[model samples]
Target: MFHTAICDLLGIRYPIIQGAMQDAGGPRLVAAVSEAGGLGVLPTFGGTEAALRADIEKTSKLTRRPFAVNITPIGRAFTESRAAICIEMGVKIVTTGRGDPGLSIVEKMKAAGIVVIPVVPSVAHAIRVEQEGADAIVASGSEAGGHVGRVSTMPLVPQVVDAVKVPVVAAGGIGDGRGFLAALALGACGIQLGTRFIAAQESEASDWVKQRIIAARETDTIVSSLMTGKPVRALSSRILSAYEAERARCSDEQERAAARGRFLSELRDAARDDRTYAAGEISGMIRGIAPVRDLIEAIINDAAALAEKLHALAGRS
Candidate 1:
C-alpha cells in the first residue's frame, strides 16, 4: 500500500532507503537492509577504495537484491575515483552526498547505466542536481546526523519535490510510521533513514554508541563543526559542551583558538577509541537494536496501519 515511484525505480519492495553511514553501515548492514526489500546504501566516506570494493563484493554475496553506494564528494579526485570504482564493480544505484559531485561524475555513472541520486539540502541544490543529470534526489535536512545543511526536513522535502521533476526522498528526523507517512504527505517518493539504522543489529557501530543513542533525548544532539570541520549533528559531549561554553566566555582570539585545538585533540582521542559517533535527533526515539529486516518490515507495517487510521479520521471529518 505504501509503494511509490522509488520502489519501481530501484526495483525494491518498499520505498525506504537506509541513509549512507560511513563506519556504521558496512556490508552486513547494507546487505541486511537490501534483503529486507529496502534500498541499502554503502558509504564511501572515511574509508579506502579497497574497502569499498570489498564491501560491495560482500554485499553482493549476501543479497541478490539491488543496493546503492554513496560517494561523499570531498574533492574532484575523490569523487571521480569513487565513481570509477562503482562503475568497475557494476553497482546499479549510486547516491552522492556531502557536496555536489559535478556534472562529469554524474555523467560517468549515467553512462554506465547507474541510477544517480544526490542528497540535496535545498530547492536550488535539488534543481542543480536535476540539471546535472541526477535520476533522483534525497532531500536531507539539518536534523540528520553527519554533515547537514540549514533547512529542516519538514519544509525541505516539499520544496525539493516542487523544484525537481525527478523523485525526491525525504531524510532527517524520520524514525517511524508517522515519519514515513509524513514524508509521503510532503510529496516525497521515499524516506532515507540514518540514525535509526545505527541501532540495527547489523550496524558496525560500537555498543557504547548504540547505548548512547538509546539514552539520548532529542535535545542531546548538537550541530558542531568541531567534529568534521563541517556542521555535523552528533550527540553532545563534555568536550563539545566545553567548546561551546568556551565559545561564549573567551574574549581573546588566541584563547578561543587554543580552546578549539584542545577540544579537537580530545575529540580525536575519543574517536580513536570508538567513544564517539555521529547520530541524528531521531536517536531519541529509538529504543533497542533489532535486525535490519525486522526494523524495515515494522516501519512499513506501522505506516500502512497509520495510513488507515488517518483515512478513517478524514472520512469522519
Candidate 2:
C-alpha cells in the first residue's frame, strides 16, 4: 500500500527493499521478499557466474514476482562478469556497490532495459551516481551493516534526496514500520533494511547468527575497519577484539598491511562457517525471526495504523 517512486520504478508492490547481505541474502531470502511484495536482492559476492545463474533460476522458480541482484565492484573483472550474468538472467534490477558505476556500466544495463540502483554513502556519492544515469540511489548511512559512511540516516537521507533528482531509498538502522514512515517523511521514496531481514526465516544466515542479533542491544554493534580495511558495522566479538589488538601493535605500513591481511583471512573463514559478521544497531529492536510473508504483513499493518492515527490527529488540530 505504501507505493512510491521506487515501487513504481522496480515494479514492486511496496517501497521496501531487502538489503543484500553477503552470504545471507541468497535465493530463498530474495524470493521470499519479492513474493511478500517487497523487493528482495540476492548478493552475488560468494559465487561464480555459473553459480549466480543457477541461484537466479532457483529464485525465479520460488517466486513469480520481481527480484534483483547486488554486485559490489570490488574487483574489476569479477564485477564485470557478474553484471553480464545479471543481464543474461533477465534481471530487472541490478544494485551496484563499493565503486562508482561508471557511465559504461550504466549504459550497458540501461540498454538491456535493467534498472540500475547504486548504493551511495553520502550526498556527493548520490550526486555522482545520479549524474552517471542511475535509475535510483540507495543512500546508506553509517548505521548500516557492512561498509558504511560517516553520516546516519536522519541527516543523510534528506541530504541525498535534495542532492539527486532520482528516487532515493534510505538504508541503515531502519527495521520496522516506524522507520519506514520516518524515511518517507524525510523525502525518501523507499526504505532498504539489512539487519531486520537477517532475522527473517528465509535468510540464509545460521540459527546461531540469528540468536546473536536477537540478543544484541543498540550499543552492542560497533563500527570498525580492522576487518576489511574499510569501515563496517558489525557485532563486537572476540575476533574483532583480536583484530583491533593486532592493528594497535602495528605502527609501520608493512606491519599494518600484514595484520589486515591476516584479519581478512579469518573473517573469510568465519563467513564460510556461517558466522555472524555485518549487523546494524537495529538488532536491539529485533525480537525473533518470522516468515517473510508475516514480517512484511506486520510492517504494512503497523504502518497503516500509525498513518490513520496521524490523520485523526490532523483533523483534531
Candidate 3:
C-alpha cells in the first residue's frame, strides 16, 4: 500500500531507499532492506569490481528481492567494469554519485535494462543528471550523512522535482515517517535515508561508531570540508578538530590541498583499523540499533497512521 513510482519502477513494495552509506552498507544490510520491501543498495566506495560482485552474490543468496549497487566514481577507473558486473549479476538498479554519470555509462546501463538513479545536491546537478538520462534523481541535502552539499532538503527537493521530469527521491534529515510524508508533500516520489540505516543492527559499522551516534546531541554535528575537498557532515570529535585546525592554518590553495590529502590519509587508515566515524546532525536522533525488518515495519506503521490523520483533515476541508 505504500507503493510509489520508485517502487513500481524498481519492483519493490516500499518507496524507501537505504542511502548507500560507505562501509556500512554491506551484503547483509542490503539484503535485509530488500527483504523488508525497501530497496537496499550496496555501497562500493571502498571496494573493487570483484568485491562488488561478491557482495551482490551474497545478497542474492540471502534474498530474491530487487536491490541495487551504488557506484561512487572517486579516484577510480572502474566505472565500466563495475557497471558490467552489476548487469551480469542481474542488478535491476544502479545509483551513482561523486562524479557525473557520463552519457556512455548511462547508455550501457540502460541497454542492460538497469534503472539508473543519480544523487544530486542542487537543481543544476539534477538537471544535468536528467540530461544524462538518469531514470530518477535523489536530491540529497546538506543535513544528510556523509558527503553532502549546501542545499537543505525542504527547498532542494521541490526545486529538483520541478526541474526534472524523472521521479525525485528526497534525501537528508529524513529518519522517520513524518519526514517521508513531508517529502511526499514536497512532490517527491520516494524518500532515501542514511542516518537511520546507519543505526540498523545489520549495518557493518563498528559498535563504537554506533554508540557515538546514539550518544550525540543535535548540536554536536558539524559540516566541514577539512576531511576531503567536499563538505561533509559528521559528529564533532578530536580527530575532526585537528583536521579543522590544520585547515585553518593554510592560507594558500596549495597548502589547503596538501592538508586535505593528509587528513584523507588519516581517515583511510582509521577505516582500515575499524575506527569510528560519524554522520549528520540526525545522529542525535538515533537512539539504538534495530534489525532492518523492525525498522521498516515501524516506519510503515507510523506513515499509515499519519496518512489517516491527513485524510481526516481533508474531509473537514
**1-317: candidate 1 lDDT, tens digit per residue:** 68889999999999999999988899999999999999999999988989888999999999999999999999988899999999999999999988889998899899999999999888888889999999989999999998899999999998888889999999999998889999999999999999999999999988888888999999988877676667788888777677778866889878877878888887777753334578899988999999998888898899999999999999999
Clashing pairs in 2: none
Q: Write the per-residue lDDT of candidate 2 for residues 13-111, one digit (tens) a residue.
A: 988999888878899999999999999998876678887888899999999998999988877688778888888889999998777757887888889
User: In model 2, where do residues sit more than 4 Å from their true spots?
Assistant: 265-276, 315-317
Q: Which one wins by lDDT: 1 or 2?
A: 1
RMSD of each: 2.1, 2.1, 2.2
Candidate 3 ranges beyond 4 A from true positions? 261-278, 314-317
The Cα local distance difference test for each model comes to 0.90, 0.87, 0.85
TM-score per model over all chains: 0.94, 0.94, 0.93
**Per-residue CA lDDT of candidate 3, range 47-155, in tens?**
7777887898899999999889998767436777788788888888999976675888889899999999999999999998899899999999988888888889999
Sort order, lDDT high to low: 1, 2, 3
> What residue pairs clash in candidate 1, if any at all?
none
